[model samples]
Every structure is written in structure tokens, then in C-alpha cells.
Target: MTQPPLTTNQDLDSARLREAFGVFPSGVVAVAAIVDGAPIGLAASSFTSVSLEPPLVSFSIAATSKTWPTLRRCDHVGVTILREDHGEVCRQLAGPVDHRFDGLTCSVTGQGALTLDDGVAQFDCTIHEEVQAGDHVIVLLQLHAVAHAEASMPLIFHRSGFGRLSASA
Candidate 1:
């Protein structure tokens, strides 16, 4: 018996690809879902807004993550726009979690989905669709409710660390 050789795109080193992408600054987000009376959330910098006519949003989740499978099966989910004050919360949610929402301020919708408090913006959504995208799932959502917190600066991500939008930018 012989072991199979590893393969990858010839022009791309995974580490360098990640590093280059890291240079592209992104906003911090908390994608959350409630299961069995507990909230499952993860800090993600890959979130993007897809549309506005009918209102839509999207976020990517690693396909290997068991947490996302649970979230996928959830009836509703929340996308929280983390503010500059949420750097620690971003770290907490991104960490290994037997309990991610420990003592975090949150509330539920009429459908029993979790929502974050004091975020710059919060979105309550129903999973509209999901599609495979390389090693991640691109999750599309139907916007149900939205809230805005003015006077809040955006939390940010760049090169694997937390950041805040430049007030001067």
C-alpha cells in the first residue's frame, strides 16, 4: 500500500494566501443561533452584505466546524455587528467554546433566536440559503429585523488580530 501525495494549487501557498487576505481589513461580526436554550455564536471577519433591494446578508463558515452544522439547522440566526468595545467579546466568541455566551448580554426574537446587545448593528434573519464555497459554506440569509446603534465605531480584523476603525479614516 502507498500513501497518496498531497496536492494544492501550484501558485498559492496556503499560509501566504491567508496572510495576503489578512491585509485586506474587514469588520468584526458575531454570527449567532440558539439551540436548546443556549446561544451558539462565532466571531467572523468574513461576513459581507450581499444585497439590499429585498434585504440580504451573508457570512461564511468553515465546513469542518461542527458549530456551523448546528447553526445551519437552527430556525433563525442573528448577525451582530460588533462595535469597537467588543474586541474582547470577539476573542471570547472566537475561542474554543463549551460556553460562548457566558454572561454575555443577549435577547431572543419572537422565533427564539438570539440577538446581541450594543452592537453597532444587529440582524435577525432566517437562513435563506447556503452554498459550498471551497472549504467553507456561504450562508445567505433573509433579513427579518434590524437594529442600529449610532455613535458606535466598528470593530475590525486585520492580520489575525482585533482592531477598530480609524476615526480619522
Candidate 2:
């Protein structure tokens, strides 16, 4: 019998590390940008509130994502907080589609960013900066205009499925 030698300090496997991160509950956000006058978007759970005073927010996209490169080049960006009904929207955006905006209810902001249909919350943002961090680009944005939905209960992602908010105990 033969055995392979182990490295002295091999750190945690990235796959396991990612799975560990999946344990955290995060809000589902759709990052939309207009390209050639059409809206393109990708679902992300990386969104975060950066500041309250200046009204800033942040989200990270993988540097290797082709879609991110295309969307990042646009001047206008919108972060739409997904509703429970948006699970399909998230899947569609992540899949291959001739047009991501197909059948999506949207209205352009004053700056021309596409706001999703009845999003829980839509943040019209200006790209402040994108800093390279590890394998992803942390997008820093300044909230230009904020719109809230007629109701609350923003969509959430957990353990690989869409989640609904449980009433506070």
C-alpha cells in the first residue's frame, strides 16, 4: 500500500470554505446595468450597507464573471432588493438568456438605471469605486435615489433556496 504525503500547512479547502460561508444569511440583490439600452442583471447575495450618513452600499462580484465585466462598464447601476417572487428572476439572470430583461417589469431611473418590477427596494446608485479583493471585486457605490416597496419582507437566500422572513420571536 502507498500513501500520499501531506503538506505541512495546507489551509482549508476552498470548496469547504465557500460552504462554510453559505451558512450566513444574506439578502438577495439583483445588480442591474444598462448595456446598449438594454438591462442586464445578475443575482447576488454579497450586498451590504456601507454607510448611513452618506448613504453608501457595497456588493462583490467575481472578477472572472464575464457578465460582471459587461455590467461594470456601464455608468448606471441599480441594486434591487428581491421579493419572495423573485426567485425565478434570480435564476433567469444567472442562466443563459438572449435577453435578460425579457418580460421583466422595469422603469428607468432619472439616471437611466433599470428598476425591477415591484422590487422590495431599489437603490439607484453611482459607482464610487471597485476594489480588487482576493478573487472578487468589491463594488462601492453611493446611493443616489432610494425607493421602497409598498410592503416589506425582502427576499433572502439560505442553504441554496429562497427564504421567507420568520416573525420576530
Candidate 3:
């Protein structure tokens, strides 16, 4: 069998790179906390588990994110893995900053971390480290506590759209 030749001279334009990156499916998470007596949060499709030894997870946020700048100052952050039915909620999160949590049910931890009530999983975490990547910052979160609804299916972001795994998957 012959392998296909790689395109060495391909132009790595932003649009092309984003389209290529969207080919892979990823789970959506809401990273939020109470900042200045209000709920501040953002939706991230780049959330991933990073380590088990120290119990860590990670998500990448654009360096220009205004929400992250404020949310990161909190002592604790709540990471909520959204359920399959949360497509609209995800959109709202990415919408206007002032209305992000409007009409949504959430729980605030004693330390002010805020998690959506209907999420598939919830994690209480603190910033462990931050790495500067190209146009983004990789945040390493050290887990303090976690809870998950085993029967709930996660919302998936794929091909620049929201979806869910089939029952047969």
C-alpha cells in the first residue's frame, strides 16, 4: 500500500487551519466563576484532561478573551461539562457578556465558583499553571472536587457545529 503524499507547500491560512481543526470532535465545557458579585463565564471547546497524578484538566482560551481576564482572578473556577441538550445554552454563553447567565439555573460554591445546574459533570478547580501558546493561553487546572452524572451524554462540537454521540457509539 502506498501512502498519500503530504502537501508541503500548503498555505496555513487562519480559515483553512480552523476548518481543519474543526474536523475533530471535542466536548464543550463552561468555565465560570463569580467575579465582582456577578457570574462571569465562557464556553470552551478545547477542554481536555491533562493529568491524573495530580488530578488536572486543561482548557485553552484566546489571549484576547475579556472574560478570562476577570474569571481567572477568582480563587476557584467551576468547569461544567455540558449535556447533549445544551446547544442553546452554549450559544448563550458565547453571546453578550452581560447576558451570559440570563435565565439559566446555576449553583454557586462557597468559594464563588459557579456551575450550571444541568451540566453532565461539574468540577471545582484552581489555576495550577498557564502556558503561553500562539494566540492562546493554555490553562492547567488542579482539581479540588468533581461530580458527574454518568447517564448524561455530553454535548460535542464538531465541524463548527454542536452534536451528540449516537446511542450505538
Candidate 4:
């Protein structure tokens, strides 16, 4: 087989890169914690399992995110894998800072990690490490506890939109 020649294009920009990246589907998750007696969080589609033996998971957040700065200060953080029906909830989390958890039902741990009641999976974790990557920070979380609903489908992010996997798929 003949390999195609690779060409570098100077016109590649963030928008184009994002569009290209959007083709890969990813699961959505809500990373939250109780800060100063209030719930603080943000939705991220970059959540993924990193290692099984260490029970590690990772998510990437924009370096400029206002919520992450405060949320990271907590002793523990809760990560909830959003259910297929949580598209609206995901949007709300990404909206205004004060109104994020307005109508959502959530539970907070003694350590201040907060998890939505109806997520597909929930994990209580402590920050294991943080690595600076380009314009974002990759957060590695060490799980202390976890719960998941085996029958639930996760909300998916692809092509810059939210969706779900079909039963047959």
C-alpha cells in the first residue's frame, strides 16, 4: 500500500482543530465539589479512565476556567458520569456560576465532594496529580469510592453536540 504524503497547513486554527477533534465521541461528566457551603462544578466531555489497578480517572479543563480554580481547593471532588438524559443538566452546569445546581438533586460528602443523584456513574476522588498541557490542565483523580448503574447509558459528546448510544449499538 502506498502511503499518502502528509502536508502541514499554516491555516490550521483552534476552530478547525476543535472541529476535527469533535469527530471523536466522548462521554460527559460533571466535576463538582462543595465550596464555601455552596456547590461548584463544570461539565467536561474529556473524562476517561486512565488505570485500573490504581483506580485512576482523568479529565481536562481549560486553564482559564473560573470554576476549576476554586473547585480544586477542595479536599475531595465528585465526578458524575452524566446519564443519556442529562443534556439539559450539562448545559446548566456550563451556564452561570451561581445557577449551576439550582434545580438539580445532588448529595455532598463530608469531604465536600458533590455528586448528582441520577448520574450513570459517580466517583469520589482526591486529586492525584495535575499536568499543564497546552491551554488546559489534565487532572488525574484517585478514586476512593465509586458507584455505577449498569443499565444506564451515558451522555455522549460528538460533533459539538450531545447525544446517546442506541440500544442496538
Candidate 2 regions with alpha-carbon error over 4 angstroms: 1-10
Model 1, 28-130: lDDT tens digits are 8888888887778798888899989778898888888878877777888888989887888888898877767877899788676677887889899999888
Arranged by TM-score, best first: 3, 4, 1, 2
Which residue pairs show collisions in model 1? Answer: none
Q: List the residue pairs that clash in candidate 3.
A: none
State candidate 3's TM-score: 0.96
Q: Could you say which candidate leads in TM-score?
A: 3
Point out the higher-scoring one by lDDT: 1 or 2: 1
RMSD, every candidate, angstroms: 6.8, 5.1, 1.2, 1.6
In the range 88-169, model 3's lDDT, one tens digit per residue, is: 9999999999999999999999998899989999999999999999999999999999999979999999999999999894
Worst 10 residues of 3 by lDDT: 1-10
* Runs off by more than 4 Å, candidate 3: 1-5
Give all candidates' CA lDDT scores.
0.84, 0.82, 0.96, 0.95
The best candidate in terms of lDDT? 3
Instruction: Provide the clash count, candidate 2.
Output: 0
Ranking the candidates on lDDT from highest down gives: 3, 4, 1, 2
Per-residue error for 47 in candidate 1, Å, reads: 0.7
Q: What is the model-wide C-alpha lDDT for candidate 1?
A: 0.84
